[model samples]
Target chain A: MSEPLLSVRNLTMRFGGLTAVDDVSFDADQGAITAVIGPNGAGKTTLFNCLTGFYRPSSGALHLQAAGHVHRLERMQGHRIARRARVARTFQNIRLFPGMTALENLLIAQHNDLMRASGFTFLGIFGWPGYRRAEAAAVEKARYWLARMGMEERGDDLAGQLPYGAQRRLEIARAMCTEPVLLCLDEPAAGLNPRESAELNQILLLIRREHGCGILLIEHDMSVVMGISDRVVVLEYGRKIAEGTPAEVSRDPNVIRAYLGEEESAA
Target chain B: MTVPAMLRDAGLAALVALALALPVVGIRTVDTGAVLGLDYRFGWVAIAVGIVFGGRLTALLLYDRLPRGPRRIRTKGLAGRSRTLVRYAAVAFIVFAAALPQLPFSDRYVVDTATQVLIYVMLGWGLNVVVGLAGLLDLGYVAFYAVGAYSYALLAKNFGLSFWECLPLAGAFAAFFGILLGFPVLRLRGDYLAIVTLGFGEMIRILLINWTTLTGGPNGLTSIPRPDFFGLAFTRSPAAGETAFHEFFGLAFSTQHRITFLYYLILILALVTGWAVERMRRLPVGRAWEALREDEIACQSLGINRTTTKLTAFAIGASFGGFAGSFFATRQGFISPESFTFIESATILAIVVLGGMGSQVGVVLAATVLVLLPEVFRDLAHYRMMVFGLAMVLIMVWRPTGFVTQRTPTVRLSDFTPDPGAAR
Candidate 1:
């Protein structure tokens, strides 16, 4: 079988004395959705942060294999992780450029590509033909994402003015604009209603099947975790207790106890 | 909330004002012909207390009448209409400025004051790139101006270069200094960044004062060559090989001709600066700067390099400040550290802020008001500042954000074709 898209070995992150993510390990494959499930403060975000280069891990090896290249994700910076590693993420809370338009938010995700085409903006300032063509292509891509998110008409509206669900979708569309090999989503359905969550599941499935990018998701909504995710990695107190197909992990006795605690363990 | 509550509030305020005035404005030392005597001006105190009480009561009543909640939508519509009105006003102002020197009432004093206003407008636009679009609060903006002026002075004196030759060089030097400051302050944000920039501005001034050999110390460098009309000197008598401007044009030599030329030069420079800044707003770098301003973490996730993006803003903004500074040196034919001070920085910042942070047209309007307010109130002597302060307070109370706070998007949906075929 082809190697998994991403492999994490012994990943641990600590804040002074508190180990947020402790010896967590998982394999997420290309064209598959892997959901990391945990109770609050089970280090789900900490793991995502480590993967996206927001925090330097205490000890870990993160290797992303894409397009015949092996990228050591642990060695890169926050922006380099997105740029060179082709890894993009949406925050737990939406972090769109509120003052900019939805179209601009997508365009910014394509910064590296546009920056090169603009000759680092020297050619762009003078509106060189090549830069103009590149910019038009970029705007086209932004429009495409807007249309896919059912927001094509609202392209010019400021991102902050968008409705709550639209903002969440816009954030995902912005991440997709980077064309990342792996998309990390932190609680995309946190504020979403059931209908929106269902829609979000379809979008995730479409991204996985069409784009063929590995998806690393951290979610608490069991419907989303069980209905769509092909693989499940259960983390308990910053430690991975089970990793398998969704059906296999859901039935695991250890997983159940970790999620619902042992009968008398607390008492 | 009620009439009685407001009356009580006003009464309490009046009592406090009386207590404060009793030790200050209520008493004065009078020269009683033979000896100085304390004059208890009880009537003045009563008048002051009465004014405060009436003023507070009136203000409270007006505040109660202000529209709230649902009426805010009308205010938004008003903002939209005002934006259009501002655009028209901007065009009219530009036309009036262009014809100022040619107007019947024009003279050296008028042209010079107008020139000073243009200089501040240019500087405000430059700093707007950093503070307005990029969200970097720069307080040391005057440092670049000083650098530009000093760079022009040193270059013209030492290398015998003309003003045109030194203009770009001065801008480049200021840009270099901007980067120098940028490197250390990249990690800072908001108020911390502002404090550092303030310190940086003062540092430049202090450095100029002590760097005697280069900047001629506090006395400053005098007799700096004025910019010529190309190679033609603005003089009655032509140098051996050089042509006098009047002679080249076959017109009479008048000092007024030079003054008009200087005015037009600055006007052209300022217009170009405005044009370039507008163009930049539509470009990728400009969008990146605005994006960085809105959310640094989001910018990082989008793969925009924070370092280069911020440095570019600093460099571009500083270059414009430098250009204005070079023009200033040529206009005055003098260079001094005193010309670039914290107050100058504050005034330029005030123009940007009062105009509206990201509004280009707002800067021009604000610059005119800020620069001309002092001149218009010159006869008021010490009271001029009080008048200025009152005007500022009134403006703030009226529109806390700015005179024009509406932001026009750099690009619109109509600007591009949204091709369905582009979707993967």
Candidate 2:
């Protein structure tokens, strides 16, 4: 009943004649998982892009309220949406800095905070005590996240060489290092096996419970969606055809028809 | 393997040998007393063909006989060992370079050549920041170098500024130019970025050539003040109210004193640049650069300001180029636009890339090889470039990633662990 953390109003994104995300509207509450599920080309990823400021929507308003401040996502730049709005994201394809160690990847996620603490490298260069303290704190924070992701022992290993499942977890850990009010994950479980998916589900649940940050997930895997998501929004042909609890959305005839085309259902 | 496969490989080898030998053996010109005659060095060609054929057959046989798994494991082990070896080699090289001028056999030519090598080393380190750490291909890095040289030349000549006074000013000017170039080409990537930067370098050069009133056109500025030892000039006689450096030290005035002094100056400057770059690599901004290099979109999504990150890399990198440029101007006592040609940029860039993009030790090693090799092969004359080109090709073929490809992670949660696989 309380106001949601993020509110989207009539978000529409069109490319030439094709409408990718057609007037989509949704609300994601704090400390809850909202899963957007649809078949291929259903614009779930497109919606995430618009919300994250990667794409300027043709017409839309995204209002994010955090710490008694409101950010107009549509007006902010991509980096501002992440830094000022405290929104973090992970790509569908893992985007870890391949040459960097696992620890450095997490540290980079805290770049802005560290840059400020170091007086943009001037104070740090002179070994200012305050800057040193901040740097140590950053290392500690990075260590805690690495331990949480169960990659503490692999902190020195190059990120690209980590096993696929571990890389996925490191990506999440990196995003969490930014201490975002909202975390957006696109297909975090795409290539993950069932066990990895189960681990991912538990990690997301723990993040929500402990960190109290809202999660926006776009997942093609139904098990991950149905298992942990508090609410599900299903899209078909870029339109929000169904939205409800997992069981309700599963039973909805429209959702069923969208998954299994009408021709197959009729046959 | 099968007999037919062996026969086919033998046939291919024969064909390759024939093709290789035809040019050297079939087309030959010989001189006779009266006119010209055609002659062939078939013996030499036959020997070359035999070596190639034998080497290929032996390699094929060995490859077939050896197990692949153990070879891979051995290479991985070697990769780990080589990293430590490289570290030791770098330390030894530094020690050698520091002691070169002090050595009994070090003469003026040796000291002078070593100083030139240090300049390229500094330039290589500067370009490494943009091309290697930041992953911005900068084909026009010489523009910043030129800016630094001209800034120092103009300042010292017109305003009568000391070399020491003009050093930082030149760096600032170069950094300004870096940001100027960075702003317009911020959106370009890869080859497009390369072309734009290449054009930017040419623009600076062409402007320097045409702007006659300020730059003295192609004639350039001359008699720029050489760096003094504080207020003391390294000359035979003392100026008004000041003693010459050698007299102040109670040592006889030898021209070698100034040459040696200049050598040490460049060495110190180069070491400072290297130290600063190494320190910055550990700082937040440097890590941001590496991250941006890996994935620009990911960097933006993680709240990193891409524009600022890139501009900072350019500015800082250019400033070092500026410092080196000013030193070059003071060293030569002159400046000309010809020194800031595209080939200068290419050579510095080659040093960075050939040394292994982000490795400081690699840059030093590469600069030494590039600068010293030609001087060492001075007798080879026209053949030196051919030899240099061949060596580069061999290096690229043998170790495509570079001589020192392993990257030490900036931040580590635990004690450093050498990951052999991280070399890539």
Candidate 3:
């Protein structure tokens, strides 16, 4: 009944007159898992980019109202978007600082906090009680999150050396360290096994329930999407074809056509 | 890991303190040896001090303290820029002589070489700023050096100003030229940046060779004034009424006084350089360089302005080179484009790279090896260039990251969970 947490109104991104995301709109409500699903080149990633401020949309608007504030996601750039509006995201490809340790990767996500300390100087690089406390708290928070993900033992391990699956897990943990309000994930299940996917499902559920944050996921896994997503938006060729609960959208003719090619002209 | 490392560090520190102090009590004079038809004096103290100095320093290449918890840095100030201020003050006190010199014996000409070594130490530290901290590989850092030397030569020769007056002017001029050089290479990356800088150095050298009116062409600017004490010019004595710079205490001045003054001047410069660089590394721009070195895209995402960051690196680095350049001119009392050759640039860069990119101690060692080693092998000075180049290649092959790489100081570990979405 309350207003949606995130509202994308007629968002369009054009590259040389080719509308990559054309007149697409959707809302992700508070504490709900919203799935954006489509085939390859369906503009799912493009839409995600627009939301995260990586790509400035050519026209229309993308707004996030969360944490007692509203943000024009399309207008903000990368770092400000993460810090100011509490927007966090994972890339389609892992983007961890490879040379840094597992703990450092997470700590960097709390860069704003560590920087705030400035030795002890609150406003500068002088000794101050405030910075020390902030730094300690940031470290504590980083440790707590790493431990929660079962990565506490491997905190000193190099981030790049972690196996593929743990690297994926570490990426998620790093993003969480930012304490984001709206978490956007692109193709989280792309290379995951059933077991990993199941673990991922539980993680998403925990985020929604415990963290009280809305999640926008672009996924191709049908079972996971249908089982977990409270609402689904289907896009094909940069245009939205259906918006409904997973069951409703699964049965929609347009959605079916986008996936299976018109059912071979069911004459 | 904790107990063993602490014990090892304690032992090493104790050993280092004793070894460094032994020379103070034992060696009061230099030893002389005549070999291969040349006058030679090799002090065991010099080589012993060199080893202990190198030993105490190379330890960093082996162990870096990564922050694990809240105790790595002691901060009693506010939580922002105040931390930066206090850090700078601490570093300054340790590096500079609060706001400020040394000894010389041996062959008369050896002092010039020693003085030159001191000058290169300052220059090495300066280049370390750009190549080490900023992760900007410069093959032509000598271009700034050239700018400074020529700035002094042109200004002092034409205007007849004292060497001290030309010092600040040379630095400002070189800094201006640094911005000029930095502008075009802003978009360049890696080898391209190296190539552009290499070309820039060549350009400066060729200009010095051909710019007859200002730089004196092949003849070079002659009679550049040596660094002098006010009203004193390294004289052995002065009249009772007139105070000689070295005779302030009424003692008969010796050649040792001039060498000591020059040694002390370069030492002060080197200390100032090391301190300034360490201070800058802890500032906002300092952190910006580290971030940009690690990931440029992430740096931009963090709202760091890239252009200013790059320019600051260039300007600061060039300023130091200029200070050294003016000092070089004053020390040698001659200015020629040949002195600022491509080899000079290569040698300087070699010092920075061999020292371990951003490590101050590393740069000093590299400079000592590169500058003093050949002098030690004056018998093979003819083949010194060949040996130097070969050593550089071998070292790079041994440690591709350089002798000591810049490490972000992290000191402790903690438990933290990452965003599960981060996997995507």
Tell me the docking grade of candidate 2. Answer: medium
Q: What's the true lDDT of residue B371 in model 3?
A: 84
Model 1 per-residue lDDT tens digits across residues B227-260: 7888889988877988999998899889998899
DockQ of candidate 2 (2 decimals): 0.59
DockQ (CA atoms), all models: 0.75, 0.59, 0.14
Best by DockQ: 1
Instruction: Give the Å shift of residue B204 in candidate 3.
Output: 4.8
Taken in order, the candidates have interface RMSDs of 1.3, 7.1, 6.6
TM-score of chain A of 3: 0.93
lDDT of each: 0.90, 0.89, 0.74
Against the true structure, what is model 1's DockQ?
0.75
The C-alpha stretches of model 1 lying farther than 4 A from their native spots are A265-267, B2-4, B11-49, B62-93
For model 3, residues B40-106, the per-residue Cα lDDT tens digits are 3335545555565556445543454544565443322242454465468547744543222222235
Q: By DockQ, is 1 or 3 better?
A: 1
